[model samples]
Target: MITGELKNKIDALWDMFAAGGLVNPLEVIEQITYLMFIRDLDDTDNVRAKESVMLGIPYQSIGDYKERPNMIGMYKTALPKDVAEKMRELLQWYSKQEKNLTTLAEFHVRYEIIHPFQDGNGRTGRMILFREALKSADVDPFIIQDDNRSSYIEGLKEYREEQKTDKLVSLMQQETVDYYQQCSYFME
Candidate 1:
């Protein structure tokens, strides 16, 4: 769970990116993910170092940075134009849909189609889907487990090719039902 302070930090980070002329929403997401990844790596390294000290073992930190030339240029070139506009349009359309699993599935598929970043699109889109589900539908978000990768990819491909959302919707619904059933069982 993101604490309010962390959320505020993230918002500040986003604002920093905007101030740095990253107006595209997809670029913003990608850049934010990069920053988050860096922070997580450092945090992981710190934890591992502490654990190693506790266990009296040598530890190699993951914070070894290799400077790459033209990285900024590469990123600038990688971000396509008008991503913010596209996202705004998508949000406007989504706001009209009934808040349900089906709508969530459709939103995820369309978000993939947008492909806003050079990488991390899938992870970011899934996060957005989960967040939206919890906020709009009042349900616990379901994970697309590793075992279901192929089916998930197939569903995405089918949607891209045929504009059909049934497979994805069914998959999401089943996952959600399974999650709730498990929760109920645990509660009982």
Candidate 2:
């Protein structure tokens, strides 16, 4: 869970990107991920520096500065304008939906269709799914474990090929129920 301070920091970073004219959602997501990575790296470096001092070892910082390249241009050139426009439309539609499992499933499928990033689209989409579920639904968010990869893929394929969300919805619902049940058993 992101603490209030970290969430505020992320929101500020997001606002900075938006103010800098990043209108593309994918670019925003990527830039936020980069900012989060940098923040985490800085935190880790601080801990390591302390450890090194305690151990009487020289600390090698990972905080080597690098020039920030024109990633906007690169991302703009990589993602076609039409695709970005379509993603914007999809996001707008998503914003209007009542938050629920069905809407989440639809959003996931549509996001996959957009496939905004060169890689990590599926992972990013699932992250969004889990976040949305946690914020809006009555169920606990569940991870799609490695053992369930085949069924998950099949569910996605079913949605893509046949416009069916039943499989995916069922898979997610079952996972949520099973996770809560396991938690309950452990608590007992």
Candidate 3:
């Protein structure tokens, strides 16, 4: 259950995104994605730290500036030993980093393949990708609006599991570029 203060933070984040001139749904969703990941990791890290102290277990915060491998090791341990903590850490990192469109698309593909969260990962990943796209290029968010569920799932699966993000990245890049072109012409 989100406390009132946390809810207010989420609302404030949404408001900040809106005020940033992100008029497209994709932009809004993407911003939410980045913010959500940050919030999740920050909150989880704090909770886990408290648990560690209470249980007398050793725990390192992911944000600590240890070597990459050590940080990753700590991240892997972040998820409950009985749960999928590594995946959560991976997706959380993906949201915070600013990658190129190709990389961003590939990261999303890989992330979805892992399916870190128990739920809402696909939609959330897409939202994060769209939000980064908004920052990377001036365009509205694109939706997978077709009724063909197989195609959509397959598209993400190809990238996440099969290492086939080239096509997905290409597709998203083209769409963003096209949208920007349209916007530019309209403004002119």
Candidate 4:
């Protein structure tokens, strides 16, 4: 069950994303992905800090975003050094982009590859994607039925292996276009 506090946090996050001027579903999701990554890192560091006597990693060893040029260092606290560097590069590349539909799509492609969340990454990413879609594209989020899960995962796999984003992007585009058309028809 969703607690009231958690519900409020989600609502507040959506509002913050909207205020940040990221209306594209992909852009919003990407922004949220970064924030979530930072939050998770802080949480993990807090846990590690309590056990610092054994881990030998001080809580204060965690890099502050204000001191660092990028968050690659923060995420590194949890990820392998090499993986963290790669994700940091991707995040920096994407974060510098201006808000646009193309950037939104690119964000979706890159963030999925980073896969920063230990769990709930896919679901949370999709939620941001949906909200951004509603705000920017006027498209409602469509559910991917259980049977289609394999295809979705396969598309993401191709992206990671080959850097090809066509399959997933096309699927999202088609779903959004289809939903918009259906809604338009109903209104007519």
Q: Best by lDDT, which number?
A: 2
**How well is each residue in 83-171 modelled by candidate 2, as lDDT tens digits?**
56777898999999877788888888777766665434566677677667656646466556567877887787787779989888888
Better of 1 and 3 by lDDT: 1
The sequence of per-residue lDDT tens digits that candidate 1 reaches over residues 1-188 is 46699889967876898899987654554455457756765676688889999999866555222122112211221125555567788899998988887778888888777666544466667767656765663545665655787778877877777888889887787777765665453233
Q: Model 4 scores what on Cα lDDT?
A: 0.57
* Displacement of the residue 72 alpha carbon in candidate 4, Å: 21
- Per-residue lDDT of 91-178 in model 3, one digit per residue for the tens? 6877686567666766776665444453345556676666655566543454433354455566665654566766675567556565
How many angstroms is residue 118 displaced in model 4 relative to the true structure, after the best TM-score fit?
2.1
Q: For residues 9-99, what per-residue lDDT tens digits would candidate 4 score against the true structure?
A: 9668768878978666555554655577668766866776688767775444344322222232123223433446766887798668764
Write out the backbone clash pairs for model 1: none
Each prediction's TM-score against the native? Answer: 0.55, 0.55, 0.43, 0.45
**What are the per-model numbers of colliding residue pairs?**
0, 0, 3, 0
lDDT of 1 at 47: 86
**Superposed Cα deviation of residue 123, candidate 3 (Å):** 1.3
Model 1 poorest ten-residue lDDT run? 65-74
TM for candidate 1 is 0.55
The runs of at least 3 residues in candidate 4 whose Cα sits more than 4 Å from the true structure, single-residue gaps closed, are 1-92, 98-102, 137-147, 181-188
Candidates' C-alpha lDDT: 0.66, 0.67, 0.58, 0.57
